[model samples]
Every structure is written in structure tokens, then in C-alpha cells.
Target: MRFLPILLSAAILAAPASAALKDEAGITEGLIVVGIAYEISRVCPDIDARRLRGLSYLLSLKSAARQMGYSPAEIEAFIDDKAEKRKLEAVARDRLAGMGAVRGDVAGHCAVGRTEVARDTNIGRLLAPR
Candidate 1:
């Protein structure tokens, strides 16, 4: 949906810069997680993101990647890579769609967010009632 592309673009901007990170699975996964939480929070009026937790999680992801020997430049370059950005965006979009959140469907997104929060899913943990 239109909303989804905006979310994906936001996620891409927030993602690492540069070409691509070297085999950093956590970084990729973490970005997707952030993107998912971000989308749910974006479309759900009654919900809010665990902003501090999300930021902390993002920082930790970067830190972990650093520990794993990926330089800041490498991580940045990875995300800056158009193909990599598209790949991550596609994954995030698919994940949301899989959960029944579609473009222009506010109710669907809210329902999914509520369900996730109620179920205490990882995405749920990153969201809460406003």
C-alpha cells in the first residue's frame, strides 16, 4: 500500500548506510524488526512504539555487529546499497502483509497490532497502548 512504501522508505533511511554489511545477520534481522514495529505503530492510532526500547535495540544491533568485526562503514554501505535496501524493504513489507496489514487498510493494521500486543510477540513487545 501507499502507507507501506512510506514506512519502508523510513526504514531504509534508518537502516545502515553504504554498500552492505558483511554477513551480519543480526543487523539485517534487527532492521526488519524495527521496520515492523515502526509500521504497526505508524498505522495504529491507539498504539505507541516502545521508542526507547526500539532505539536501544537498534544501538545494540550496531554494537553487536561491531563486535562481530563489521566496521561502521561496512554496515552503512550495506544499507546504502540499493539492492540491499530493496531486499530489506521487501522482507518487511512481506512480513507485514503476512500478518494481514495491507496498504490503505487502517483497521487491518490496527487489528494486527492489537493481536501482536495481546499475544506478547516480539513485535508486540515493541508496542503498547497509547
Candidate 2:
């Protein structure tokens, strides 16, 4: 009987983890992180260089996101949506940079820190695998 309580608690905890993501929108944060990692790879062919830059960029973005009024959930959704739409990344990047090559639509709205995070991550080390 004592174990019943423990089992119930475990089930409750696990339920949220298992069901946290019911759709693509639910997992956007992860997508953003992954996309940043990919961008890092593209920028730096060397692992060591990418690792430091990627970590710094991620740290800055996370801090900025917290300061910005976006819940972690919203950031994730935005990242996922952008990653899924290939053109969105390019458009968003230009918009954020203010180069205006693309319309000030996607990037304009992106938090500057978030855009920097994507642009700054270096993935050469990430691709090499420890």
C-alpha cells in the first residue's frame, strides 16, 4: 500500500514529460536550440571554435529571452516554426540584421538576442562528436 503513493507520483510526473509535446508547436524550443547548433556548424568548420561561440551565443539568447516577455514555450514555437520553414530563417536573419535584403517581417519581430544566438553558434566541434 505504501508503494501505491510512490507509483502514483511517478506516473503523474512522467505523464507530463511524455505528453508535453502534442504537436510541432509544443517542441519549438528544442527546435530553436537544434537550429542554432546547425548554424554554428555551418559557420565554423573547426569544432573548438564552434563550441565556444555556440555556448556563448546560447547563454546570451537564453538570458535575453528570459528578459523579453516570451515564455520559454513561445520561444520554442517560434524556433520550430522558423526551422520548419527554411525560407523563414534567411528572411528572419536579414530582417533582424536590418540589412533589409528580405522584408522586415520575420526577423524584425525576432528578439535581437535570439537572432544573434542563431548567427553566432559554431558547430564544427558539434559535428565532430566527442
Candidate 3:
């Protein structure tokens, strides 16, 4: 899968809404491309791109949440919720002091890595494996 579409989508999202008619299509297409690329890479380690790209995406989300005035308690709630889904997200508050440096796309890389791990072993297998 190609990721050009994802980057294109980001560009379209960056564009003004009034002038988005033509660019919207490309943006949509780019996102699809990026998603496909991400999935393909997740299934095949040999093709996975650098993990940093995914890390950047995660950081962006955290930044957005911060801008939205999420309180410390609120952020703690979020961390608690995410901890069940991802162990690393449950890091101690003290350890998170410098977590601002963590990129957003780290989630993507984590997802891909998890997928690869699941594929290689039954570590995360449910009651049954389909």
C-alpha cells in the first residue's frame, strides 16, 4: 500500500474549508493510501517504515488535547482509560514529566509492532484464534 495518499490528506486538511472542494478528494485519497500503507507494514515487518513517523502522530494528538484545556485530572483519566488498551500509556506521573517529547505517531508504531508480535506468537491470543 502507498502512504502518499495519507500525506496528501493532511495537506488537504491543512487547506482552507472554503477552497477545499478540489483538494478534498485528494486529501481523502491520501488518507486511504496512508492507512493502507500502515496496515500493510504492520503485517510485514520487512516493509514497515521508520517508527518515528508514527510517533509524531501521537504527539500531535496529545498537543491538541493540551490546547483544548484538558486538566491534569482529565489527562490522568485519559491515561487510566488508555492503560488497559496499552500498558505503556500507564507510566507513572513523575516519569511523564518529559513525555512531551513523545511524538503522536508512536501509537501507530506501537500498533504495528503489536500486530507483528501477535502474528509471531500467541501472547495476545484470546480464548480462541480465528
Best by lDDT: 1
lDDT of 2: 0.35
- What is the C-alpha lDDT profile of model 3 across 55-78, one tens digit per residue? 354344435545656543443344
State the lDDT of candidate 1 residue by residue for 26-107, as single tens digits.
Answer: 7788777777887888887988888777777766776776787777666545655666656776788788888899766788
Roughly what TM-score does model 1 have, to 2 decimal places? 0.78
Pairs that collide, model 2: 28-76, 29-76, 40-121, 40-122, 40-123, 41-123, 47-124, 47-125
CA deviation > 4 Å runs, candidate 2: 1-49, 82-85, 92-130
For model 2, how does the per-residue alpha-carbon lDDT over 1-130 read when each residue is reduced to its tens digit?
A: 0101221122112211212232333233332343434433333333212344444554555445556555555544433432233533443343334532123333332233343444553222223322
Position 9, candidate 3: lDDT: 35
Q: For this target, which candidate reaches the highest TM-score against the unseen true structure? A: 1
Ranking by lDDT: 1, 2, 3
Flag regions of model 1 displaced more than 4 Å: 1-22
Evaluate all candidate structures by whole-model CA lDDT and list the values in order.
0.70, 0.35, 0.34
Task: Score candidate 3 by TM-score against the native.
Answer: 0.31
* Sliding window of 10 residues with minimal summed lDDT for model 1: 1-10
